[model samples]
Target: MKTSQSYTESGYTHGHSAPVLAAHATRSAATSAGYLLPELEPGMSLLDIGCGPGTVTLDLAERVRPGRVVGVDPSLEALEAARDEASRRGDRTTDFMAADVAELPFADASFDVVHAHQVLQHLQDPVGALRGMARVSASLVAVRDVEYRTMSWYPDIPGLDKWLDTYRAIARANAAEPDAGRHLKSWARAAGLEDLQVTASTWCYTDPESVHWWSGSQAARVSGQTFARQAVEIGRSRADVEEMRRAWLDWGASPDAYFAMVHTELLARVPARR
Candidate 1:
């Protein structure tokens, strides 16, 4: 079951397949940025790390109009998708590049604000990535990540627990923390960031439109996404994965179905130059 690629070192355990990228493309700045949006100002350079599909990155470009904005990720395909999105939006201000979080290619203090959304959870060395971010940020660093263990759904369907357990196992096997929300502050401290401000938020899907969208996305992910393949690699059978997919669909169909996921957000100030 060993593939040539090592998922542990890839940082993104959930490989950027089509379904995953589609899920990411649904995220918008208002929904994903949390507390970071209020901090943006015109004429401030911004960098978004692991900026998948550039949906949020384009929103940021609008916010920091007349300023520099760049989105960076390790996947060239993701970057290409992001570039296409920028083109579709007719946005010429934003730029997308392929770069690693642990070793950003930009010079030190290159940006006024650096942000990452749902990025740290996938990294085996999140603190190392933060250090690199801190190096490039002149004024601030903002991040938000989910605590997957705190995810909850009502009217749970059969095999839902198994699905959660399998996902946790796969993430651990990749040396990534599935529940990264609780560790943002500690990781920030380890990265030597100062003047920290931390907050919590929740993304709740209860309305029919939201629930159906979220559930359908998860169903596809568990059925054919990289995580599903990794689950089999870790000993879960294909039948089990299919059951999980059905469970997601069943949950989506329930009359009283609801889902909520908790996230932690933080804004830390990078120390001024000596």
Candidate 2:
């Protein structure tokens, strides 16, 4: 998802590039949204904010049959891909729209559940985004984000550290929080949401297939537009970006390479009507 409202910084950090979308399209509800599955019930309306390519959104729509499921993103390009994915899946009911998390164009209490994945981290005011989600959610609000600073990998590869540093700098330059997983609880509380249940999950890439895809996509991402472009804008040299891209490729080829990303999930219930 992309957000350009209520912020002075530049647009989405990753932009709407092919590599970014390819990486995001691999996410599924089972893998990315397992924590919220137990709470899902059929016939419940859902609003997926920042639903990027809508891979998870489409999977989620399957769980809530005969119910409305809408995916929203500030990036029209992302929405177009999402719509195309829906069409490919032969899903006729799911709807994709262009909207920012800062100002959802929906009535109060319009959805049974409001969810966002990897979206809040990109917002300058995540708490404000949560408030908007809470306003439109009658029952629950769920969100997930990764803490980039804690991401770990084995076989201490060269240039990886530089990659992390440069990525963080770029995100900060855009006024987005790269390490946002740890702050989900605080953000939700600050939004006045109550009954929060927080949990943690990990995405490990050690298997051959997983490692290849993860590393290749990252290399492509850093070498491609947006990330690479932003790194230069933040005083990093093109040589530094190229080095990181090479590092990712090297890591992918190593048999002992392992990577783990930590994500925090928050499930909060909307306060009862007063």
Candidate 3:
């Protein structure tokens, strides 16, 4: 898919390559879903923005069965893959569409809940997108994003440190925020949302299996993803990028290795329509 000006110029730094999609497919509704809403009514309508691969969208579909659930993204490749996943899972209720968050095609107050995950960090106008989402939600709007600066790994691997530096630089070059998690609430407020609730959460990789998966996926991402190319465009050498990839692999191989990435979650209640 061609990049959209509505999104970051880097346009999904972790492109939907096989390795990246494989990692995303591992996520499920129960495992990484529904932190924004404590409970979902069966009849609640939902719209999931930037719903890559639709894993979490399907989970939300299950939670609100007999209600409409739509997952929207600008990438047709991601929407097609998500449709295939839904078909494989026998999920007929969830729908995938190509839409930009800053200008959703839906009418005002069309959904009971609107959610986006790991999406705002990649957008050049996150607050503007949030305002658009709020316009379509009748009651709730939820968002979660990572603070790349808060990411930590054990044993102080130099390569990993370099990886972080390069990734942050690339994000900045794209005019997007790399540390968006800490600013979610403020963004929501600036979007004119009130009755806000903010919380922080962490995704920790400690077990050998989890660490291996996390580190291996990141290694492939740094070496083979669009992110790698963007890093080069910003004057980082290929050899340096390879070194970061190798460091990720080495960290994955370590028995004592652990990595934790912090995310900030915000759930805002939309004001009732007059």
TM-scores, each model vs. reference: 0.95, 0.96, 0.95
Best by TM-score: 2
Model 3 residue 224 lDDT score: 83
Preferred candidate (TM-score higher): 2 or 3:
2
Candidate 1: tens digits of C-alpha lDDT, residues 2-66: 23121232546678878888999999999999598889899999999989899999998899999
Question: After superposing candidate 2, which stretches have Cα over 4 Å from the reference?
Answer: 1-10
State the weakest 10-residue window (summed lDDT) of model 1.
Answer: 1-10
Q: Per-residue CA lDDT of candidate 2, range 24-96, in tens?
A: 9999998899999999999999999988899999999999988899999877778889999999999999999
RMSD per model, one decimal: 2.2, 2.1, 2.1
The residue pairs that clash in candidate 3, if any, are: none
Question: Native-vs-model 1 lDDT?
Answer: 0.87
lDDT of each: 0.87, 0.90, 0.86
Pairs with steric clashes in candidate 1 = none
Report residue 248 deviation for candidate 3 (angstroms): 0.5
